[model samples]
Target: MDITSPSFKENATRAIGDKSLQKALGNVERGFIYKRAKAVAAVPAFETLRDAARDIKNHTLAHLDLYLEAYADKVAATGGHVHFAETAADARDIVLDICRRVEAKTVTKGKSMITEEIALNDHLEKNGITTVETDLGEYIIQLRGEHPSHIIAPAVHLNKEQIEADFRRVHDKLPPERNLDEPVALLGEARAVLRERFLAADVGITGANFLVAETGTSIIVTNEGNGDLTQILPRVHIVVASIEKVVPTLEDASAILRVLARSATGQEMSVYTTLSTGAKRSGDPDGPDEYHVVLLDNGRSAMLGTPFEDMLRCIRCGACMNHCPVYQVVGGHAYGWVYPGPMGSVLTPTLIGVDKAGHLPNASTFCGRCESVCPMRIPLPKMMRHWRENAFARHLTPPSERSGLGVWKFLARRPALYALATGIAVRAMALLKPKGGRFRTLPFASGWTRHRDLPAPEGRTFQAMWKDRKAGK
Candidate 1:
């Protein structure tokens, strides 16, 4: 889609005011948070698994070049083509070229964020190749002409009612009197429609959750069986993935997979964890005849030796986003990019530049919930802080925010002055407090008081309270 990260503030304002969106956002907390907590609680070694996952990713990243070479060699040995794409444009061109060589008229796709990152669908459509999204959520959003709001749950921002409306509008060929009030009905309708597309497709495209270097396997984990059909029922199967997605071995991938589903959808294991090595074997009953992998760098290799390199460890499990308060409130659309939440805050800035996506890093409250729950233990808040510093250094941050930080920095350097100023300001605010011990508006903090009242400071600074406690007074 378009880079809307620049308009994040405007998008967040509109999202907060949208009642329908607020209602849909409620599902995020209710559906994901509790389920993840329960799933994690059930696994006694979950924390240990998280550490293993992080170490696996770190090791793979360190030897990424070697692993990638090994992976390409393995794919070649199995009669598969491996194309390395240095840019998003290159990735798209490679896929298009493959499709043209195959004389592909229609393509079916599994849910793939890399495809979204490269804007593959738009490019293919523009080239007269009809592309269809086979995943249910993807199909719904495709009909609505929208990008995924959440990484794993694309239609999480939408409700069943809205989906019913879209289904009715787009599937006008279906019976007008047909029932689609239930989610099952919606699934059945989508399945029926996508089944046709699957059979008719000349090529099927998928995103890899992990690419195994040892076996040259491209693996995808999905709750629905759509991924299997999308990859198997077509003449050509194309895998599009970022370079960082490659793991050194299948064992490393399995270890990482241990935490992926729990952190993502709270399942012990996803219903379908399919591994494709290459094209169909001689005795294979059903498989693609042609297999290809397009490995897109897209600025990832640039992050390798940088502070943001830790972000590459992301499994796309989305635990960070699920627990991010900012994302929970505003939803993914507010971030205005292909990715959203804490991971997006750091990654978006690197891929698109802090100049365009500066607001995303500043969007966090720095509560650190994202880091706490991340399967790979990515320090999301720290990465966001890095982006913030990058933005400020590049003069991309707004002047008002820069001045505010400048004022804070001056006071921060002098402890006594900072304490005295905070003490005086706290007492003054306490004296000015209304009957309910809250301020409906503040002189320089109108943004804070706009949506909710600010509580009075209780006539003392945190330092004073701590001093008193230390003295046992």
Candidate 2:
């Protein structure tokens, strides 16, 4: 996907005006927030699990080199191939080489964000290999020639009516009068259409929720069973994952899994928690003939010791985005990259230079809901602040914003002048208050007033109010 984080303000402005998108975004709050809260409330130890998950990831990342080495050794021992990719292009080439070697005509994919990050589908299609998304949400967006709006819920930006239209448009062979008015009807049609593709696909690619170093197992947690078929039915299974996914043991993966589902979908466990170790064994009834894991770094190595290191702990559960006020309004596409929401705000700037993605970190309202709900307890707001600081230090921020901040800094350093300035401004605004006690338009603040009215300041400033209260007035 192109780096449109640079145009986030424009994208968000457009998103705010999109009635369909606004309707679709309502699902985030209605579907995710309450369910997650109820699920966490049921599990009294949920907070403890979050702490454990954070610690597990921290320890693994601290010793990531050793764990990755151990993971590769185990994969090789189990007859699976491990390809280390330092860049997105390298990862794409590795997968392409594997497909070419196997003479793969068709490839089936489970929901893999890393592949999206690398633009793998476009690359494969351009190279003459047909790639099909087995995940229902992925398939819908793929049909529309768009990327995922939300990580866990790829087509969350769409409604069943829109999906029905896309299905009618794409699956032209299906009966024209078939009822796709409901989500179940859409599911049945997708299942029927994808079943044949599953059998015909020569290669299957999936993203790992966790890569167990102890057993060389790649684990995927999904509500639907698409991931199982994607990795099992094909002749070759390829796991594309970032290096941070590796954990020291199955026990560690289990500890993290406890919080993953609850935080992600509010389920105690996903319907399908599939783990693939390697190729088919001597007496195996059904499994892939070959297994490959394309471990991608893609700038993650550079984040190991930085403030952004905590972002690598993300399990892609997407709890942060679900509760983020800004994300709930603008949706994910406005952020313009594979990942979205608070996680994207921090990670995008790090992965794609801060110069290009400087606007993302500033997108947050700093509500701290993201950090509170994060399964890994990642300090999303803090990391975003770091990005803002980095952007300012590098002079990547706009000159107007810099000048505004510089002026604020000058006033802030002088307490008396700051107090006098605020008092005068507050009284002036009070005198100029409109009939409704809100400013529909303000000089030098069109950006703030463009979409909504800003409330007029009260007649008294903080200093005046504080002094009056202290004197018992």
Candidate 3:
């Protein structure tokens, strides 16, 4: 919740040293990558679905203002209240005021990154309302008094033993002898604990996966059904979501849904895809007495026409982050924000300002995996380069990096100079007599050599070879 993006290098350094976090992050590769690969491979039309999803979101964004008004009108017509917040402060105030109006003592929440972005839990708790995160992953981090490390899998940075300890520490009264040795036992216990909170909650809050303008519906997709309970069990239901979540129609939403789960968790569809249009009508079986939709802009509106606008098309499926090599090592927490990974590298700078989040974009290797795997097909590497250019132009980049780039730029612009310099450098590298023909340490490449040896240069420069071939020498 705190803006620690400025200290990302330090945070990443710390994360790298944490053995437990290293073990936990192994799941990112072992579980998510393999499952997503298999799932995508099985669907011959998955790429077509991604293209369709991207187009739907693009059309929606192009006419976003119109769609937003239509969505609001539909929500109001369905007896749901819509509140637009231009800033994070406005969103937090709007939610707190809603809690106060409901006379709420306790609020149960589904997993909503928008709420995290707005720091809603801290605001509600400070205002005398007890906010409980009913999502299993969120609940674990809440109990640990920490923010979610990953967006889709909030507690993925944690291991089973760590979770077992948290449960033991928090559920002390639930019998110390209870077996939590397996994932099922742990889940059953959390379900039981959260069920009581859900029943007692005065207000239920959730994030929307998609808001359908045609139907005036807010949709949530979940594997555990906690989102269903969080939004329906209380007298008041509050939907806190970013404005970009709006889709033109149920059909459009369905298209996006086709890719969301496959991209996110490798499932064809999540277990629960609940859609709510409004408040309870007369003779309705059971539903919330009040339904409020809080649409938070939070700098997203400013991004509409910029190079970064493509980022708005993001589904938050986390496929970008899941495939990112940088994120694979540092994990989400190192990004030092609610959002993390390649998507976070782009969006965090837009939301929080590039000056503070400059390090995130620089963290990438530009392998292009993030863009290749993204369901939205956002040009992540290009956007990251855009951020770097902005940082350099603003003189916000570190002087050392800027100077290094300046030297490289000068050399790169002149073909003859570049050829000459590269040839000399290649020969010099060979002279280093790199043990086993690899450098254990290098002057300006300590960062890389520290982790692994730098192989010595091989063969003559291509320029010399080209000249020889041309002359038939």
Candidate 4:
């Protein structure tokens, strides 16, 4: 996806001021924050487990290439085909080729952020294949013709009434008078519709939570068992995942999963944790006849050996977004890309160019909640600051901002000049201070004074006050 970082400011301004969005966001923020806290509180050992999870990821990323090769070998040994893709196009092409070989007319998918990142559904549809999103949230967004608004809750932006309307519009078999106001009723209707698709689908596609090198297994976590049916019922199963997903064994995968659910949706675990080793064994009643695992590189390997290598440890738990102040205001769409929040700000500029996504780094309040909550312990704010510094050095920032920073830098380097300027500014601000210590309009700083007042300084500067105290003593 192409991103225009400048649009971030405008979109964020509109999103924050939007009442409907604010209402929707308010519920989500409360729901995620509180539920996660509750879940974490329930699990007394959660913090200690987080450390284990972090170490597992750190170790895996350190030897990523080795594990990837080991995983490819294991998959091949278990009668599964492995395809290495260096880019998104490469991955999409490989999947399309597999679909053509299998003569697949319809494909059912589990919700995979990797699939969204690759724009797999669009790619498949363009090639005349029908792609069905089996996950409820993904299905709703698919019908609405919109991207996922949140990582875990794809249709989070929609209220129940809007969902009812969407279901009514999309469910052609539904009677005009059918009442669907209740959540359970709406879900039942969707479940019935999807059940038929699952049986009819020629292929199943999903993103792996982790690829186990020891057993050649691809793991997926879901609250609903739809992912189970999606992978097993079809004739062909294709696993699309990034290379960073590889782990040494099921034990290591479990270590990561322990933290994944807690950091993500705040469940002790998902309702269904399915691990597929390969195609169906001899005399097996379910699962695909053929299994294909597509390991996507897609600039991830490039991040290795760079300061950004720590980012590869991410398990997509999305805790950072939950705690992020900037993300809470604007939501994911305002980031103008698939990924959002603290992780997006750091990763987007690297995947796409710093020149295109420089604004994301500068959009933060830098409260450090993201770093504190991150399971991987990624230093997000520091990384964002690194991007900002890079942008400044490269002159990728707006010319106006660059000029302003240049003036500030010049003043900052000289104490006498800075103090002189500060005294004049404090004196000027005192003159501009209106009744009630507020100004609707002021000179030079009308940008600040137009909407809010510039507070008048309290007499002497800190340096001046300290010096006078010393002199008196």
Prediction-by-prediction clash tally: 0, 0, 0, 0
Candidate 1 overall lDDT versus native? 0.94
Error of 4 at 262 (Å): 1.0
RMSD over all Cα atoms, model 1: 1.6
Please give, for residues 1-473, the per-residue lDDT of candidate 2 as tens digits: 67798899999999999999999998887689989999999998888989999999999999999999999999999999999999999999999999999999999999999999999999999999999999999999999999999999999999889999999999999889888888899999999999999999999999999999999999999988999999999999999999999999989999999999899888989899898998999999999999999999999999989888989999999999999999998999999898899999998887888888899999988989999999999999999999999999999988988998999999999999999999999999999999999999998778779879989998889888999999999
- lDDT, candidate 1, 366-459, per-residue tens: 9999999999999989989998888889888778888999999999999999999998999999999899888999988888788899889889
Over the stretch 26-66, how does candidate 3's per-residue lDDT look in tens digits?
98986788888889999999899999999999999999999
Instruction: Indicate the worst ten consecutive residues by lDDT in candidate 3.
Output: 426-435
lDDT by residue for model 4 (231-349), tens: 99999999999999998888999888888888888888989999998899999987799999999988999989888888988888888988888888787888877888899899889
Per-candidate local distance difference test: 0.94, 0.94, 0.92, 0.87
Per-residue lDDT, model 4, residue 293, is 96
**Model 3: lDDT of residue 445:** 73
Misplaced by over 4 Å in model 3 are 466-473
Q: Which clashing pairs does model 4 show? A: none
TM-score of predicted structure 2 = 0.97
